[model samples]
Structure formats: C-alpha cells, structure tokens
Target: TVAVVLFTSDLRLHDHPPLRAALAAADEVVPLFVRDPGVHAAGFDAPNRAAFLADCLRDLDASLRRRGGRLVVRTGPVVREVDAVAVECGAAEVHMAAGVSGYAQRREERLREALGRRGVVLRVHDAVITAVAAGAVTPAGSDHYAVFTPYFRRWSRERLRGTCPAPRTVRVPDAVRGEPLPSRGELSGLSPGLPTGGETPGRERFARWARSRLAEYEEGHDDLAGDATSRLSPYLHFGALSPVELVQRARSRGGAGAEAFVRQLCWRDFHHQVLAARPEASRRDYRPRHDQWRTEDEAAEDIAAWREGRTGYPVVDAAMRQLLHEGWMHNRARLLAASFLAKTLYVDWRVGARHFLDLLVDGDLVNNQLNWQWAAGTGTDTRPNRVLNPVRQGRRYDPSGAYVRRWVPELKDLDDRTVHEPWRLPEDRRAALGYPAPLIDLADGLTRFQHARGRGVT
Candidate 1:
C-alpha cells in the first residue's frame, strides 16, 4: 500500500508525527508539498517568509533524497493539489498535521471530503505543529483557558508524548512527478539580516545556542544589545524545528533558564489553544473595549511614521528598524512596539498587526494578532488597561542605550544618558541630530488613552 505524507507547516524530518505514522503504515510514502496560491492571495506569503520557506523546502527535499526518496511539489489550492497527488500516487492514506487557524481547518475538511470520495483516508495528526494539541487541556466549564496563569498550571501537569526519531529510510515510487524546488535567489525584498532556514541550520543553531546561551537566557533575554535569547522562532515557525524535541531537551537541561524558556513555549501553546477555540479572534477583538480606534485616514502620518520607524522614540524606533532589517525582533522589543502603537498611539490593534504580518518572518495569526490584542487591551491579559510608557520601558530595558545607538545612528554620538531622549539635548545639538521630534507628547497620549477607555481624563 502507498501513503501520501502531506507536508503543511511541519517541514522537517526529525520528530515529525505525521511522517512517522505515514512511513509505518505504508510500503511507499510520497512526501508532498503544495505551493498554494491561496496563501499568496491571503497576503500570508511575505517575501521574507516565502524566501525562508524556499530554503526549508529545498533542505527537506535534500534530506528525503538522502533517505532514498524525494519530495513532490505542486502548485494550486491546497485541497485540490493534495487530492490530485493522493489519486496519482495511488495512496491509501494521506497524513497531515492539524492546524489552528480557520483557513487550515477549512482546508483539512475539504481535503478529507475530496480524498474520501477517491477512497483515500485523510489522517490528521495532533502535536505535530505544536508541542501540545489545542483543546488538550481545559479549565472548568470552558473550551479553552482564558488566562495564562491558570492555563500554565494545567499545561505544566499535562504529560506530553515522547518525541519521534527521524525515519532511517523513506521509499518513494518512480512514477511520481513534481515541480522543481524553489530557490531563495529567485525571491526579492527579503530582510537583509534574515537568517538561513532548514532543519540542519535549525538544529545547529539550537545546539550551539542552547549550549552557549540557554543557561543565561533568564538574565540576558531582555538585554537588547546582548541578543542572548534563542533566535529559534523562524525555525519553529516553519516547523524546521520540532517544539516537542525542544521542550523535552530544554527540560532535561534543567535550570531556571530552561524553565523560563519552557514557560515561554507554554505561552505559544496558550495562544494556539485560544485561537483554536475562537478563530475569529484573529481579526476581531478577543475582549472588546469598544475602542473607536484611529484609522489610516485619521492618523495617516503617525501610522506612516510608526511603520517607517521614526516615531521619535529611540527604543521603539530601534525595535522597528531591527524588524525592518532582520524580519525579527527581541520579545521585549516586540512588546514595546506593539504597546506604543496600540496603546500610546491608540490606533486599532489590527492596524499594527497587519504591519507586523507584512514584515515579521515568524508572524502568524495566532501569535501576531493575539499578541497585538494583548498589547491593545483586547485579549486575555488580566490587566487589560495597562499601558507601557516607551520612555520608561527604554530606560528599563535598554539602559545603556546601546540598542538605541545601534539602530538610530543619528543619536550615536549622544551619551548613554541622553541617547534614549535626544530631544533633551541642548537645542542646537538636538536640532543638528536631524531626527524627527516626538510625534505625540507622552502626557497627551496618556490622557487620550485614559479618556478612550472611559476613565476620567485626569
């Protein structure tokens, strides 16, 4: 019997549940990937992510070939391509990882119905794309946990299945045909500092970073210039790295850093479960505050300034510029930027989320949208009305102003004390810097937010 392993987000060979199951259940397995036009149509295929995906596909193909098989590529809507491949390969079963987004759910349903009509069974595997399946554990009387603290408690106690090892061999029949693999060189507009992708690079990075930096992550993760946090996100985003393997390995390493890292992963799982239960939260407010948010028309110049990284707040600008260059940002930086746009600027969270999706290589519906909601006070954050003062945040997180100096070169000559607030410099010196003035005064912004939230404008 033959099986078709439908690769979606889970791209790598190691610790992949769907691939393992397909291999065990069939004599021959056709590894298939479909370049769905729907993704591009939905604006999910940003150049940076598309380029990274090309590297992942090529690397996956190379790995399969080494194990006596090769990946089959197709282009079309995912359901159509998958159905066509299953029938052509004479596959008795088609296995794929479960997905949380509404689009993914709809695709899975379409795949199942189409494949079933052709007498092929569609098997969806859980815990392949994520470390734990969404809806695996729930709080009392709820479909999903609404709060991270309680969710984390339940999540910590829920034992996970052991990780799968890579298959020793993958056998493919010669009759299957596929398009040529995509190449990074064929793409444009990628962030100049974007990291290379694929399982090999992912594994190597995890090994090196976990060894050299994981131990100090607890202390250094917030140090903007230190850059000590594991930059494993894009790899994880593409499924080039398995969350199961990562969590297990980190837990075994056994330290406060590992624990902190594990807690962060729980947050990833938390958002997945929340999104799974409430897919519409991707676009709608999860917890609406009746915000009459500013639109592009109402706040065009401010929005433009924010996107261009010239809001005149050194730390926020530095974070935005890093994202523009690297397609990634430090976690702390992301929070500050999100907060500045959603809270201080009082623009709609969707506005900021869309901009992030356009640029962030690791951006996805669950995390990007929900994190924006959290910052905008429309998500599960218990303290929804809180606002991050960017100046205070900068002083606390980027103390020496090295992170500010690195990206805002106009302020490079300023001393550490003044780099974060160069507007404080002597009038002549500040005017010479050529940096834009603070777009909105901090006090005025705060009053605006308070009034919008219906608190007395004190």
Candidate 2:
C-alpha cells in the first residue's frame, strides 16, 4: 500500500498529522509539495515570501532525506500535479491538512473530485494547520463567533491534539519522480534583514525563547524599543512550528507571560475561524461601514510618503523603515503604522493590506486582511471609531526612542522626549535633522476621520 502526503501551509515534519497518518497506513509514502501557478495568478507570490518558501522547501527536503526519504517537488496546477504523482506511485490515498482560504478550500474540493475519479481516496486532516480546527467551536446561535472574547473563552477550554514525533524512518517508492528543489538565491527583492526560514531554525529559536523570554512576554510584548516579544510569527505563518506544540510548551511554563502568549496563539486561531466562516472577508468588508475611502488619485502622495517612511511621524516612519529593512515589523509597530494609513490618512484598508502582503515575510491572508480591517474600523473591532494617534502610541510603547533611532538614523541625536515629535524642535534644529515635516497635522487627520465616520468633529 502507498499514500501521498500533500504539503501545503503545514510544512514541518513534527506534529504533522497527515504525514504521520500516511506513514502508518502505507508501506511507503510520497511526501509532495507543488508550486501551484494559481497562487501566483492570485498575486500572492511576493518575492520575500517566495524566498522564504524556497528555504522552507529545501529544509523539508533535507529533513526527509535524513529519514531515508525525500520531498517530491512538482510545478503547475496543484490538483494536476498531485493526481499525476498518485497515478505514478499507484497510491491508494492522498492526505493533506485542511486549509482556510477560499483558494485552499476550492483546491481541496477539486483534488477530492479529481482523485475520486481515479479511484483514490482523499483524506483531509484537521488540527494540522491550526492548533484547533476552524468551526470546531461555535456560538449557540451562530456558525462562528464574530467577536474574539467569547471565542477565546471557549477556545481556551478545548483540548489540543498531542504532539507527534518525527518518524525514525520514512520509506518512499522508487518510481516517483520530482523536480529539482528551488533555492532562495534564485529569488530577488527580498528584504535585506529577512530571517532565514526552516523548521530547525524555528524550533531552536522557540526553545531559546521558551527558556529565557516567555516569562517577560506579557510585560514586554509591546515594548517596541525592547523588542522583547518572541519573533516566531514567520515560522508560524509557514507552519515551520506547530501551533499545538507551541501551546503545550507555553502552558507547561505556567506564568502570566506564558498565558499571555497562549492568548495570542488563540488570536491566530480566532482569525482563522473567522475567515473560514466568511471567506469573502478576504476582499470585501466583514462588516461594512459604507466608508468612502480615499482612492489612489486622492491619496497618492500620502500613500507614497507612508511607504517610503518619510511621513515625518517619527514612530510611524520608523515602523515602515523597519518593515522595508527587516521584512517584519513589531506587532505594536504594525498596529500604529496601519492606523496611520487607514485612520489618519483615511486611505482604503485594502491599499495598505496589499502593500503589507507584498513585503511581509509572515503575511497570511486571514490575519493580514482582517487585522487591517480591524484597524480601519470595518472589521470586528468592538470600538470601530477608535483611531490610534501615532505620536501618542510612540510615546507609550517606544518611550526611549531607541527603536526610532535604530531605524530612522537621522533622528538619533534628538532627545528621547523630542524624538517622537521632531516638528516641535526649533526651525533651524528641525531642518538640521533633515526629517520631513508631519504629513498632515495630527488634529486635522483626526477631524477628517471623525467627520467621515459621521461623528461630530471635536
């Protein structure tokens, strides 16, 4: 007997349900990854993510090889490639982790139909991509929880699946053929400071963080200057680290910080379930506010300035510059930067979401789109009218101004008190610093947003 394990968002061998099931049910298994052109057509194959994905594939292949097997790589349509491999290997079944996106759901449906025609069964595994599968828990009256607090209350109680060890040995059929694995060197336009990707690096980082930093997470997660949060998001986005193992490990540590980090993991699951229930939220508003957002023509200069980190809002510009240089931004930075664009600039959330997807190494459709909407007052944020003031946010989170100095070097010489509001400096001194003036007066932007949202201007 033979089975094929189709690798999608879930890339690692550890705690991988589909792979383990395949190895158990078949004498030999074909571990497969397909480079689907459909993803490119959907405009998701950005260079940073592409480069990161190359590293993931290479690492997966290397891991499999260490177990006396190799990942079979193919290109073109996903369903077609999987079918061809199944036919070649004469596999009795194909197994894959369940996916949340509309594209992933459609791909799964197509694969089932196509493989069924070939007299092979398709087994879709849940709790593989996510710690808790989408739709596992629901409100008494609804298919999904629209708000997070209620969902988290329920999600916290659900027992996560046990972790699976990497197989001591994996047997692959001799007849299966695969393309040469891709290399990150072949890709361009990647962020210069983008971290290397792979399950090995991810696990090592997690182990170190769990030992040393989990205790400080609650107190320091939003300390932009301290950078105290664990940078495991890119690994999570690629499924290089299992959500299940992370939750388990954090809970074992048993502290306020560990609980806080677990809550964040729950947030990831929360967004996934929301996206699963409402797939159109990817392109359309989950809860529409009839916003007359500024188009590119109206907002071109502001948007360009925001993208180039020249908005003259020191903290916001620092965040944008960090994103450009590192391909990742602190969580607090993301919130303020997103707010500056969606709320202060009164630009469309979609515009900012598109740019983030282009550059973020850890960009996932559900999180990126919904988080942007949440910031823009069009999604599930209970306080839809709330606007984050970048200067105030900077003063609170990046109090020391070290984060700004690191990213926006021109402002390094300024005092911590003056760093966030360089415009407050004397004319000659401000000019000497070479930072641009604030894009729009903070008061003016607030009034514009309030008026647009039908609130009386203060």
TM-score of each model, paired residue for residue: 0.98, 0.99
Please give, for residues 292-377, the per-residue lDDT of candidate 2 as tens digits.
88988899999999999999999999999999988899999999999999989999999999999999999889999999988988
Report how far residue 108 has shifted in candidate 2, in Å.
0.8
Q: Write the per-residue lDDT of candidate 1 for residues 1-458, one digit (tens) a residue.
A: 89999998889999999999999999999999999998999999999899889999999999999999999999999988888887787999999999999999999999989998988999999998888899999888999999999999889898988998989899997888899998889988989999999999999999999999999988888999889999988898889999989999999999999999998989999999999999999999898888889997899899999988999999999999999999999999999999999889989889899999999989888899989999888999999888899888899989999999999998899888898888899899999999988999988888899889885211
Q: RMSD, model 1, all Cα superposed?
A: 1.5
Q: lDDT of each model, Cα atoms only?
A: 0.91, 0.93
Q: Best candidate, lDDT-wise?
A: 2
Q: What does the lDDT read for residue 278 in candidate 2?
A: 94
> When superposed on Cα atoms, how far off is each prediction in RMSD?
1.5, 1.5
Residue 249 miss distance in model 1 (angstroms): 0.2
Residue range with the least summed lDDT across 10 consecutive positions in model 1: 449-458
